[model samples]
Target: MEGTIKKLGQTEIYRGSRVHLVTETIQFPNGKRAEWELIQHPGAAAVIPVDADGKIIMVRQYRNATDGWTLEIPAGCLDHPGEDPLECACRELEEETGHQAKKMDFLYKFYSSIGICDEIIHIYVARDLVKTEQSLDEDEFVTVEHHSLDALLEMCFQGVIMDNKTISALLAYRYKYKL
Candidate 1:
């Protein structure tokens, strides 16, 4: 379906460390034209780390976007453009949770916002983990916690888990493991 649209041009709106904003003009298959505001991102990766005891490692961090602390799976943006998301997931899991997994598997990838943003977040499942020291970014303040899958499902049911990527990743984990 995307092949039906032809890009006309794009006007730069803003550029930042993480994202670039632009208004893109396009001509539809029907000859209609429109302008759409798009957010260009370098993408990101997240991991659901499960330990030997079957507890999932999670992170508690403050998000200015929500004006509060959020409980989410360990995640981080790609180091730079053209970086491997799998490597980002592996790096973020250890950096945030202080645990490195011996068995890491790809779960899925998703668009953060379909309408306006081009951010893609790759999700993974990490098991057989061994504890290491957490290496956080200067701007990051994260507290690592562990939870049972049942407890995480309850958090989602009660709306406590609000991050979309975390929610979807949890659901996928449940489906994958038949839990």
Candidate 2:
């Protein structure tokens, strides 16, 4: 069974320069209806930059949503429309962590929340890092951190690292590389 979207009622619960509030009415196949509150976003890109020593260049940042500092991979949103995700990843990595990757590899894409919003996240891996100067976004507050592969994996198991995109990508990389 399937039903079409009869109507959507959304109000700006909160608005900011970057993101906005959204609430929509979704009608289901069985005449059931529900409301969804979503954060309107322009999608994002996460980069896992690896150093020559096989360590991952991560970041320690305060996430307002999480109410604390989180250890996460360098990531950023697409400010320019039609900009490539790989380019965004490379740029974010360099800007946030002061490292540029010689090789950028596309691993996979995922949705942060499929229930309400249409935000898609592209995950990429960057290797052969080169030291560079950070050029962080004006509104962004981030601190760079580098972690050994073993320590990073341990953090994942201990739930110390709380970024879902980073965790998923690291796991996938381990599985793919058979590490």
Candidate 3:
């Protein structure tokens, strides 16, 4: 069974330089129809940056949507229409954490919020870090934190870290690095 899109009634909530609002009407295979309000984002990139001693670099920031600050891996949205995900990940790691990775390995790609929006998040593991000045965006407010892979995994099990992308990244890191 497959659902088809019948009509899309998109109203521009805010025509900004980055994101836009779009709504659609989808007809399901069971003859059910529904409307989905989506914040059309150009996707994003998340980086699990590891330092020389193999500790992961993360960030703590306040998310307006969640109404509370959360601990998460370094991530940022695509700024250009055709920007490469890996490049975005590299940029975000540098901007948010003030570190650059000499080599970056791809981990996996997933959606941040699949129920309402279609934002694809690409995850990567960056190693061989070098410290530099953090270049944060004007609208972004964040602080960097470092954690061992073991401690991060513990946080995941303890429910202290509860973001999908972060969790996914951690799991991927575990399997990929054989941790």
| Candidate 1 similarity to native, TM-score | 0.97
| Every model's TM-score | 0.97, 0.86, 0.87
- Which predicted model would earn the best TM-score? 1
> Candidate 3's residue-wise lDDT over 1-179, tens digit each?
55564663555566667778776776776667777788878999999998988889889998987898888999989887779999999999999999999999999998888886778999999998889989998978999989998999899889888888998899988998798
Worst 10 residues of 3 by lDDT: 1-10
Residue 16, candidate 1: alpha-carbon lDDT: 92
**Best first by TM-score, ranked:** 1, 3, 2
Could you tell me the lDDT of residue 101 within candidate 3?
Answer: 91
Model 2 C-alpha lDDT per residue in residues 39-60, reported as the tens digit of each score: 8877889988888888888888
Weakest 10 consecutive residues of candidate 2 by summed lDDT: 1-10
Clashes of each: 0, 0, 0
Which parts of model 3 are misplaced by more than 4 Å? 3-17, 28-33
TM for candidate 3 is 0.87
